[model samples]
Every structure is written in C-alpha cells, then in structure tokens.
Target: MEQRIQSYDALFELMPEMGAQKELLGCECAQPEYCFTHYLEPGYKEEDILVEICQSVTEKKQDSGQITFKVFLKVSKAACIFYKGSYNTLHKSYAMLLQYIEENGYEICGSIRESYIEGVWNKESEQEWLTEIQIPVGTGSLTQCIC
Candidate 1:
C-alpha cells in the first residue's frame, strides 16, 4: 500500500461566536462528556486558540443555540507525534516535529491539528495527558518552489 496521508471530514463542536467557554456550557449539547476538546491555533499561540470538540456523528442536529461546524482537513503527507505531558510544554514537541519534517524532506502545508486523546477528567497527572500532533506536510518540488 502507498504510504499516503489520510484525510477526512468531521463534525466539530465549536466555541460560541464570542469565544467564551462559559457560554459553551450554557449551549445545549447532547452527551458532551464523550467529546474531546481540540484546539486550533495559529503558530501555537495561546491567545489565538479556538476551542472545539470532535463529535461522534457527522449528522448530529444542533440545538437552537449550539455552535458547530463541519470541516474537512486535507492531509496529503504529514509528520505525526504522540505527546504525553502538560499542554504548556507542547512547544518542545512541536520544535522536534518540525525538525523531523525538515530532515525528512517535507514542508508543512497547512494548519496543525492537535487531537487531545486523554485530558483533565480522565487523567489525574498532567504528565499522563495524551495528545496527537498532526502537521500536514508536502514534498518539496520545483513546481511548488516556483509558486
């Protein structure tokens, strides 16, 4: 089988338009416990982060006040790493992952995706939290370089 990146469309529970976590709790959502909170931020900046939750179903009907969206991620090639630690130390992992991609002849092509596998409620220790970093990449080529 070809070692190609896999991409997919997913339903995401988004933060309220105002980007308030407290408002999210007030919004009606079913079985919120099963959802894992994910963050999308530009360049790992804390202030730029947007909170979201991955949904189990793609066609889930949202309540009147619910904030959600369907998004598709295209991952043609990528460098992935599993991180186990506090969110505060993710910069270390990101640095290492970026180095790995550069050494392997791939360049980041899109926004990074951090999927929280284990977190606060499930894990007591900050060191036990699990996160997966998916950095979309693409092979360098003259065609790409020209543009």
Candidate 2:
C-alpha cells in the first residue's frame, strides 16, 4: 500500500440512500436534523460533520437494504490509498493503507474519500474493484466548528 498527498477540485455528488442513515429529510444544508450528504468546505472534518448531519435528520433505523442519502467529500491535500479486492475484504485494504500513511508520517485528517476506479457491478470477475481511499492530511483539529 502506498499513500501520497494530493490536492483535488471541489465536487458535489448526491447519494439516494445514505448507508448509515436512511430517511427522507428535506434538502437543507445547515439543518441539524436533515439527512442529506454534502460537500464540506476545504478545512473541515468529515466524520464530525457526518455525525451531526445524521443527528439532524433522525435517529430511527431502517431496513438493512434501505437506500439512504449520503455525500462525498471534495478534498485537498489528500493521502491517496489505492487497492483491489472483494467488497467484503476492502476493510483490510484500508487498514494497510492507514499503516502505510502512518509509516510515512501522515495523519487521517478527514472522512475517507472513496472512488470506485473499477467494478461498477457491470464488470467481469477478473477485474477486481479498484478504489482509492483518500484520507486528508495536516490539521490543528479534526473540525473547525464556527460557533
């Protein structure tokens, strides 16, 4: 596993069903109880934001297969970790990538940015899913709360 820091352009993608939380909350970016994925500004923590966002929407659980809305981060100075594996074993890939990042003196600064480089459910078995685990680097705190 290899980790390299790189900058990225801001992006906004929508998730119909956020895996962690599933409820149709309206689309209000700042709602403390809404359930929509959003693009965090450059210097923010994805995990903290995700928790707050999940709270704003609701605290109810849904069926296992329910599709929930979620968001992906648009990051800069990200430590990129690329790998190929079965979906079930992808966690190992992340662990290895994190180890490599630590060995190289980088810290996980934000929510893990994931990109499916391959295996879109329409590809063959020989082609394992290629994903990039982009963890942000450099920070004073994981979050910058403007209270």
Error of 2 at 81 (Å): 1.7
Lowest lDDT sum, 10 consecutive residues, model 2, at 1-10
TM-score, one value per model: 0.60, 0.44
What's the CA error at residue 23 for candidate 1, in Å?
A: 14
Give one digit per residue, the lDDT tens place, for model 2 in 8-115: 211111232342224343333343322312224443342323311222333333434333334434455666776786655656876777777778776656655565
Off by over 4 Å in 1: 1-42, 50-53, 56-58, 62-66, 141-147
Q: At residue 15, what lDDT does model 1 achieve?
A: 19
Off by over 4 Å in 2: 1-74, 139-147
Query: Clashing residue pairs in candidate 1, if any?
Result: none
The TM-score measured for candidate 2 stands at 0.44
Distance (Å) between predicted and true CA of 1, model 2? 30
Error at 69, model 2, angstroms: 10
Question: For each candidate, C-alpha RMSD in Å?
Answer: 10.0, 12.7
Q: Would you list the C-alpha lDDT of every candidate in the order shown? A: 0.56, 0.45
